[model samples]
Target: MSVVIEQPKSPRSRKAANWEKYGWMYMRASGAILLILIFGHLYVNLFVGQGIKGIDFAFVAGKWANPFWKVWDGLMLWLALIHGTNGMRTIANDYAERPMVRKVLNYTLWIVCAALIILGTLVITTFDPCIDPNASTYLPGVCAVK
Candidate 1:
């Protein structure tokens, strides 16, 4: 039996801007940064001080109280969301045969990502450690004074 292989199609004739190139570069860059951000987050949350046992609302509140951690977490949130969305877009482009389906899937992915990014940014920027009145008992000593 003989097997036949078809040659790939030629590139598009129009010389449009290379978005895929940029997306590929972004994936590499973001993956590297994400490695650092994820590992640092894990180290701080799981290995420092009392470790996992120390994780609580108060612990999160304490971390977000600092601007550095806030920016770090916010950056992680945005980058991860964008990176994941873009990766999924690439997959949808490859696997989805219908153009409308691909468009809908991509749009949904982007909308969800945008919403989460906005909500996450707002939370990171406007978070108040002492906002809860009923949970004061579970809060840290700092919340009592605030």
Candidate 2:
């Protein structure tokens, strides 16, 4: 594939910041990082020890007990959500013929993305494994009895 770089419309004429260019770059960079994060996540959750059978509430509690896993999962959530939303926005802009429809779709897409990112980050950062006292049967190892 041949790539053509766009020159300034006029010689020495500075152009405003190119958002589409940055968005494309972000998609590429986030995709590479998400590749590693996702594979590592899958390997740890599905390939380590008893594999899928061992994945339970306790397994997740234990994993989230450490700060490292929290950050790793958080990064994955944020990157994946944004990457998917940006792709959708690009599709909307390209395919939606009506300006009003494109505008509404882009706005809705970003709104949903922001809401999900906020909620997911809250879940990851504020997750408490020992929230329920009655469900200590499986979480006993991860949580201490009061």
Candidate 3:
């Protein structure tokens, strides 16, 4: 007796637009962009000035004060979260045996990703270093002067 392996049937309804293809392209594009963004971020934070020792709340505040860094960080947060969520979705589709389980996992992944992206963007965009009254001693001279 021999066991027979059968190929899965294709979907009967074909969509005019291909989402899987778009998702594949997005992964490649986002990965390239993330490589540059992550490296540049590391170089600036870890290699510049006093190196790793220079990283502090004040340092982050100073960076966020600049519109350029704000955009950079925001883009990085959004891209990375979406990229991760998409990757997890693909994994779920491939490995999840139950349709309900796959659907629940994918939904949870996107919900968490969306929530984090929103919170991170808000923090980056609205960060105020001078808001803490007790932080004057730990904060930079600029915060005290302001």
Candidate 4:
């Protein structure tokens, strides 16, 4: 007599390049990058120059004024946001059993992530130093001087 065997269910089709595999790789990569970026940010903000006291609106404005910082912040923004979102997506997929509910939640997550990323990039890149120069309270010193 021949014995019968059963195959376990897969979340995805066998023929496809697995998104979960890519997501796992991304988690590792982004996590490594995040550690470096986060530590650099902490060091600069908490240990360099005047430290915490130096971190006012002017400080942020000055940092954003530089292309280097702009790029750094943009990278941090995108990587961290996507990493966090993907992590949550993993959790949601694991817990949410209903197909319709999972689909809705996942859709919401992507929409929110996209919106935030776009808005953050726009804010970082297009921020003006003279939007309201005379409004010193709202303006950083750099902006107020303009």
Best model number under lDDT: 2
lDDT by residue for model 4 (35-124), tens? 999899999999999999899777888788788989888999999999999888877777777777777888999899999999999999
Residue 85, candidate 1: Cα error in Å is 0.4
What is the overall TM-score of model 1 with all chains considered together?
Answer: 0.83
Alpha-carbon local distance difference test for all models: 0.84, 0.85, 0.83, 0.81
lDDT of 3 by residue, 73-119 (tens): 99999999999999998888778877788779989999999999999
Task: Kindly report which residue pairs in candidate 4 clash with one another.
Answer: none
lDDT of 4: 0.81
Every candidate's CA RMSD:
5.7, 5.0, 5.2, 6.2
Show where candidate 2 strays beyond 4 Å: 1-15, 134-137
Output the worst ten-in-a-row residue range by lDDT, candidate 4. 1-10
**Cα TM-score per model:** 0.83, 0.86, 0.84, 0.80
Q: Residue 70 lDDT in model 2?
A: 96
Residue-by-residue lDDT tens digits, candidate 2, 1-146: 22233332323326666666778889999999999999999999999999999988889899998999999999999999999999998888778877788889999999999999999999988889887876566677778755
Q: In model 3, where is the ten-residue run with the lowest total lDDT? A: 1-10
Residue 116: error of model 1 in Å? Answer: 0.5
**Model 1, range 1-146, lDDT digits (tens) per residue?**
22222222334337754567667778999999999999999999999999999998889988887799999999999999999999998888778877788879989999999999999999999989776775567665547643
**Residue pairs whose backbone atoms clash in candidate 2:** none
lDDT of model 3 at position 6: 22
